[model samples]
Target: MRASLPIERSLTAEQTTALGEFRARWAAVRRSTTPADRSAAEQAVRLAYHAAGLERPARIVWCDSPLALAGRVCRASHDDGGNVRSRLVDHVRRRVASLIERRVLRKVLVAVENSVNPADPLVTAVAEAVIRSVPEPSLSMLGHLRCTGLSWSGVLHAIIAPRGFASCAAGPHDLSWLGVYDYLREVLRLHAETEPLCGLMQLASSVGWLQPHARTCWLAERPNLLCGDARDRLHQADGPALRYPDGWSVWAWRGVEVPRWIIERRDQITLAAIDEQMDVQVRRCMIEIMTPECYVALGGATRIAEDETGILWRRNWLAADAWAAVEVINATPEPDGTRRHFFLQVPANLRTAREAVAWTYGMRAEAYAQLVQRT
Candidate 1:
């Protein structure tokens, strides 16, 4: 139940200053960074560790994309009598066993997302399968939450693999919410522009996407966004001074509480190993996958670049960071709607037995394990 940060040895002034310099250099050099940039940043950090005469942090790997697997099954629920869920679950069990046999590890993580409309039977079944996978020491059901209601819709949750509690802990600042938001938004926009959502909504609905009637009823009790008063409030809040209103600040309503299951579990999840490279204020953990390489490149420099898929990538992690930094900016608006600001930066739990099959291999350690058997 304790959520506060644990006390740790504070860095010396010299070390602290060095850290700041490193971050600035990272941001600057990363201006054109891409997936390649991510690896470069890690390399830079590694070089810094050696130059600073500090020990490199150990890398620990973790996993959590469980609900993603369920999503695959749910998408196929309309086909072949919708037996995909059962088949998916069976695949998950075998995969876990296979990982165990490979001596990967004992514990795995899993997650499920809350339904916004009415709960769907397929989602429920997926949840059940995921829950059953836990309980054994081999599995640890960290927690679950609802999508922030932005782009993820029903597909934001995850589960860790080879279960056990994370050996390291992450802090709020260690997270890059702006990075996440930008990544998701950019991905959605690209997909929409190219393939487009097409029948996605219809497909989801046919398979129980909008079944959360209770949720809809609950949300209906709140104020509407179209009202003049509401508009005024929104306008005042969303002004230049505020950048974009804080997600919680604007979306929060009185007398309404997100279910404990949603809030108590996790605010962020990471796969990176615990290390000195992590921001002190952020909450992050190590995963074995080679993601920071991709993320670094995606976040730092590659502005308006095309992804590997040849799709236009417009998601700006820096912009998302800018929006999140509004609170930090603490801008005082003049008669005109503008405020000068200093730069600022900052920062899922889920359960279930649901599983996914990987179609390929030769990824990083974590990615390889995920894809080994299915491919």
Candidate 2:
């Protein structure tokens, strides 16, 4: 019996004639008495079938006469087996890698061409203040503190505030309020020259670094505080206080406020008596001012943004799950008709901070090239 051709479409006269000749050749080869001749003929038929785009049956029986013949034929064509396919795959991979590199290079060039100086007086002032205020160890600890997934401001307030061992009287923990007073003394000593107590405390409270009780007091008593609007908004929403380890607590209102007392008495506060009151409170807790080196080390990254007014430097740092960001607006006019002063905003966690710093450094060349291209 003659095998049926696996053509999907109607064949032209020439193709039909060619197929007839091929079938005849196949028949003649099959009729050969010698095993070797029959083998060669079968191989030729299988190759022809493949070239004609005929798909083999899904369930192939190698031992069956016709199927075995086709299998032998296909095997003959692939004597080298898989080597060519692997080389082709590798060639495609290399091409893809090259394409990606070229694209990145182009993007970097574009970025550089459009770049501007990101330096601003505000950024400098904030950086300087951080450097002067925070110690290295304390700065490093910021990241770890963020890992707890609590508010940075809340933690800061807890560190700075006087301990309330009296509050923990019901708990298994035994503590002393004396330690709180001692800690305050140390804080006064540390911040004696640079910042005022009221300012620091107020800043901490405003930023969510203060304990719930203290923050509530500030908000209730000083309803006229700069964060009055924020306080009102929070009050309207009625959020719950977040508690942390070591008796630290904070509410949802995280706003920026600069108290008038701090501005006025910043230079006048004296730390003369703080030394005598110095005790274990400072040593037991983690509290230090932020510094430039520590900030950079903590993975602070900066970028420049331009608008109709001028260019601004945008700084970002990672802390735990959150991001602490600041924008240094360039000579931009405020609602108050005064140029803005330099100030550092929020603090970030450690790992993210480190990663940001690393990424910025690693991409510096590409970034510069892009900025240059923009110009």
Candidate 3:
């Protein structure tokens, strides 16, 4: 359980300076919207296996997304429905998963602290603090309020991954910790093994998610159209947040992942559909897309309550729970001589629109009442 090196209590002046340099370099990697460097990724994967003293795979299978590997991994654990590829991939996974973890991931994932509980105290805490202090959103993606300019959207988020995949590389996103290692290495001037670290970086920079196996490696191609909001959360209002070359796409609103229909098929995100959504955030996104004015006027939103701040509206689904929103008019008039109306979605506990708008601003109703809001 020993750490690779002893980290000091605080970063030195030079080390703190290196943090910015590394953040910019890593952010470019995470923000890459290029196709996978197939030849380079293949070479890197082979070199990583060699560094770990494992046999190089006979072939590298190119996939559009991690979901491709995930799908095969799921079928391997369950029924393959007569898919020969699934069966073969499943066989390879069983034979090599344990071996790869012990021999390959263990050698390079030192950054993940061998255990989530690192032998070194405060390693994760320090890592968190270092990343979160940066203003760049993608670089500080794992923490809250790391970037400016964003009001509320994407200030917080969750990275949900499918189960069944074993230890693997997450392309550039792996830089979240790898860059930390770079910082530490430069700062401390430690003489740790360099081959494994280099191989990890090469693999991460050349491909998307990577899964190694006995005979073949699964390497996902980087999305050709990856984007993020101000807070560095995956988001696209008009189309897919991230889209792979093979037409595979993930749609998002603000930062919340939702169905493609909610983003594109505007006519389909009806009041009934919004009410049917169990996740409150996803439903709110739908309302945002539909525009609160249309949602209430067309969908028969009842006026539940009203106050000086706004009017509260509610609608109950036939078989599901009810939804509530606060309608507030923007005090500022547009060039066309009309005021803008905004609908703020609030928690179920809030009764009045005043509380709802106040919640959006992250304040108590009493405190918010004392000030005037333009929007």
* Top candidate (TM-score): 3
Candidate 1 lDDT, 6-71, residue by residue in tens: 222333455334434433332222121111223333343333233323343232111122222222
TM per model? 0.14, 0.15, 0.66
Give the per-residue lDDT of model 3 (tens digit) for 152-219. 44332212221223222233433344554444355445324333555556666777666554455668
Segments of candidate 3 deviating more than 4 angstroms: 1-12, 70-163, 166-175, 185-192, 275-280, 318-320, 333-339, 369-375
Q: Rate the local accuracy (lDDT) of all candidates.
A: 0.23, 0.26, 0.58
Which candidate leads the pack in lDDT?
3
lDDT of 2 by residue, 268-373 (tens): 2123211222332221111112322233344443434333322233333222222233333336888888776332333343223223332444544346456546
lDDT order, best first, reads: 3, 2, 1
lDDT of 2: 0.26
Q: How many clashing residue pairs are found in candidate 3?
A: 0
How far out, in Å, is residue 70 in model 2? 83
- What TM-score number comes out for model 1? 0.14
- In model 2, what is the error at residue 44, expressed in angstroms? 99
On the 0 to 100 scale, the lDDT of residue 320 in model 1 is 28
